[model samples]
Target chain A: MTRLLTLACAVFTMTLVGCSESGSGDDTLTVGFSQVGAESGWRTAETESIRSEAEARGIELKFSDAQDKQENQIKALNTFIAQGVDAIILAPKVETGWEPVLKKAKKRGIPVILVDRGVEVEDESLYVTLIASDFIHEGEQAAKWLAEKTGGKANIAELQGTPAASAAIERKQGFEQEIAKHPGMKIIKSQTGDFTRSKGKEVMEAMLKGEGGDEINAVYAHNDDMALGAIQAIEEAGKKPGEDIIIVSIDGVRGAFEAMVAGKLNCTIECNPLLGPMAFDAVEKALAGEEQPKRIVVETTIYDQSIAADVIDSRKY
Target chain B: MPEALKKLLWPLAALGVLLLFNTAMNPAFFSITISDGRLTGSLVDVLDRATPVILLALGMTLVIATAGVDLSVGAVMAMAGSLAAMLLVDMQAHLSAVIVLTLGVCALAGLWNGVLVSIVGIQPIVATLILMVAGRGIAQLMTDGQIIPIDSSPGFAFLGGGTFLGLPFTITLAVSAVVLTIVVIRFTALGLFIESVGGNETASRYAGLSVRGVRLSVYTFTGLCAGLAGLIYASDITAADANYAGLYLELDAILAVVLGGTSLMGGRFYLAGSVVGALIIQTLNTTILMTEINGASVPVEYNLVIKALVVFVVCLLQSETVKQMIMRRRAVHD
Candidate 1:
């Protein structure tokens, strides 16, 4: 029993030692960041940007990868609050399970900044500023390109992103709003690809079979991964993809441009993911007691086959 | 009625009632069509979507028959695809078909799992869990965490995208696997031995059956199923993203297996029931997406609720007390 107690003490002491090493620093602007993990390329870039930006500004950034779980993110946030960090940044896994944590942060006077994703809190005072791309606008840009390319008439299919994500919800709404204007444009079938390439291909193949390859005038994806997957399904059906069935999607990742250069993808809307520098700028302003808006929209651009080749060299993310 | 039929009656009846209710609500629910020499619409979609789940559940049925469970099938799928992608990187176009390469890699991954469970004497859950966490990481490491695009594999494309006699090739593969599993379980003595081992390992050993061999074979078989599903998955996309392929598929496969009346504690097995369970799950998902409920949303996450409800209903039906109560109530009404 004595040995067992010593062993337990040793383990607990080791954890405390590790925590102190990670948390100790003087003249440090402690910033707690809860990430969604290395789930995608965009997320990795976001992590890198935040790490580098924090380093450059001499801020001690305590980073936590929640591994795509809401409970993990909440635990990390509470840990940060307990440590008494100056500020907190969260990329919420889901929108609803955040009100309680954000409320705790608000009670402690710890300002929260939402990056890349948004939360569904009814209280506007929970978060200081939300730095995210205009998801609906990204959808609108893709739809606008498809409309002009198809002359305001096409039988289209939609490959949506993950269901619970704010990006997917807003993007679908935005695309539907734009497509609703044109009487000739119709979405014959739509399904959630779950922001995954494999599922995108599977759903796209089903859509192709149901609508008939020729009936599908275009394909609109919530992101580049699904669009790329749809391209594969189109080619497998012994039909030309970009020429026979046009494709439009969002996310300005390099994969989209590569597809564009190959003439397999027609258009892609750029949703800038590297928001670390701008996010830090907001953090600085908020720390200085300046009132920041509840919403901050990031800039975006639409790239088609025409500009895809030229812009391929300069595409950062 | 036979004992097996008696065991399966309630779940089948429940599934029928659910289908009947759904068809009543939607006029176009039962509209299945074959147009222009191809199967079109929701039926085709359900078949295509159920392929992976059916494959995994078939393997899982055998694994559960040995009193063991594999929570790593989905991760193994990703790992197998990632390994195949890595192998194809150096191979010339004329060297091998992508389908052959994918199968080879998947087989090797299955073998790895088999060795860990049988030789290392690790708990099946822990053995596969290691692979589950590390497999995706390995896949990411293989592709340098990038999506590897493959556009020129005709054989590969056919596995996922091509149709065999007006049916998707994936469905054909799944059906073939189910049939093969049914043959193994019914025609051969392997099924009886597996049940004996799961029922009581010591008793099976005393009876002179190779219990270790049975356990090893089931794990390997599960791995092979996951591998085949991975191939179909990658072929459908024509690209491999190590991060997202087959994510959370093991959960769905387990759900399908459990829903089919296969006990998590092990001993009897069912292949055909699992196939039907996969279809029921896919149909439930489709119904949720098609139906417009006030203040409710349709997304992958929403499927979790539907899955939970289905599991609850199936479990309730499986309970002898509940079944007897329902029968008594029906008799009184009649």
Candidate 2:
């Protein structure tokens, strides 16, 4: 029994020594990270950013890919709590059923930071902060740019993203609210593109055909992928996309930047998926018990043909 | 109508009716204007978009004829498109090389599905479902989970966007594929073999029919069709978005097959009906989009409801009760 006990003690000491040596410093912070699967390019980018940030900051990240399941995420959180992690970072796939797990984390005094998306929690103190991009503001920026570029006199076709998704709903809401301010700008046709390039192109083709592709003056897609698709549809119709119909969309993916550079897409509002650095900073602050904003809204940029040349090459995603 | 014509009649009529509705809803629906020497209009769009479904339905008709379902066609399309794009863009491969390799990969995927269903005795639905789920994720992995947009040769792009004899290449490809599938299945004993397998698997084995080869070939053909569709779709957007490329299209293919009057129970298949059914589906979708209530587009949410009603009506029209009523009415006339 003593020999086995000694063996266990030696292995535990070796693990502690190994953990102390490879991490940032002698003081290693264990952060249990439950990410909502790498289902999309954005999700993969976000996950990559977090992993790199954790490495750079010398924080131990116990990463769990939930594969877009809340139950899996909850299970990961439970495991993290069982391990008595220093802090927990949750990139929730959905926005509900998080109160119980969060409350459990709270009792253990683990500072939980919500990254990329916000979770539904009745209690105010469940999480330290939600670090996310304002999807609505991104939409508003795209619409505002379109209005300015079109001199507020344009007949638009709106290619809404996936229905009921928080981003899609917010983006659509924001665009509608902003466009409502400009009476000269009207959404002549609208359809859900399901936040994909192919659907965007198909819906845009139908939208253009319905209200006369010539009558339409602008195309507002919720993302760059859809905008790229709409551009193709417009080109197929023998109409100049950027000139005949101004194309403005959100999400500053590399493809969108390339489109803006090629004069196909007129503008793209940035929705940076690289939330890793900011998320970890918030994590560090929260763990330090320092007061942080309840919501750390990431800043975004509006890129048109003018600045696209300068920044297109620098876009990570 | 003759027996063969009767099989083709309903789906063809359904497609025609949908096109008429589209034209009525928007006069521009039927107006195919020459744009840069290519046809551009809603009708053209319907044909272009329906190409993938038509190709998918072609394979589906055979698979369903064998009383087997290949749900992986959609995902196979994603994989095939991804293989083509990634190979072409990353490896600087020739377009023909990309096409050949991609089809090869798709055929391999079908072989795996075939091996599972025929050799392992796994249920068809469950076997294809494996690829239906994992295939897209694998495609995503190949592209590093990004929409791989490639600058390809105009010749490659022509496969999707180019015109052939004043009609879109998609329509040409779909028609030729349909014709070829019909010729291959009808002229040879392949069609008979498939029907036998579907009609009675145990009896087919007892009759000395190569049941395993029939099952394998149908799946392989389905995979090849899916690969061709993936090429077209990838060429359409000039990008391979693994997640969305041919997403949920298996359901559409199956719907087209069912709409064509092919029994899901798997006998007496109609390839022409499946193609027409695909056209009807695309026409219905275009009609819905063209439909406007007082110059405002139909509420996007109600699109499904409208589709459901149309499907319900079509199903009702094909129902036994309706057929009985038609028979009674004919008797009354007599």
DockQ of each: 0.25, 0.61
Could you report the Cα RMSD, in angstroms, for every candidate shown? 6.0, 3.7
Candidate 1 runs further than 4 Å off:
A1-35, A48-114, A118-128, A150-156, A179-188, A208-218, A233-240, A243-245, A283-294, B1-49, B90-127, B162-172, B183-185, B259-261, B279-334
TM-score of every candidate: 0.76, 0.93
**The CA-based lDDT of model 2 is what?**
0.86
Who wins the lDDT comparison? 2
Residue-level lDDT tens digits of model 1 in B1-334: 9666766666677678667866765434456667556675666777887898889898888888788888888887887677666666546434256556666666666667777877788888898888888888887887767787655566666777777888787778887888888887789999999888888889999999988888878887888889888877776676677888888889888878777777778888767777777777777766655543332224456666876887798878877789899999999999
Clashing pairs in 2: none
Q: Candidate 2's residue-wise lDDT over A168-255, tens digit each?
A: 8889888989999999999888888888888888988887777555689898898888888888888877788899888999878888
Give each model's whole-structure lDDT: 0.79, 0.86
Q: What DockQ results for candidate 2?
A: 0.61
Candidate 2 residue B279 C-alpha distance from true site, Å: 0.6
Give the lDDT of residue B135 in candidate 1: 80
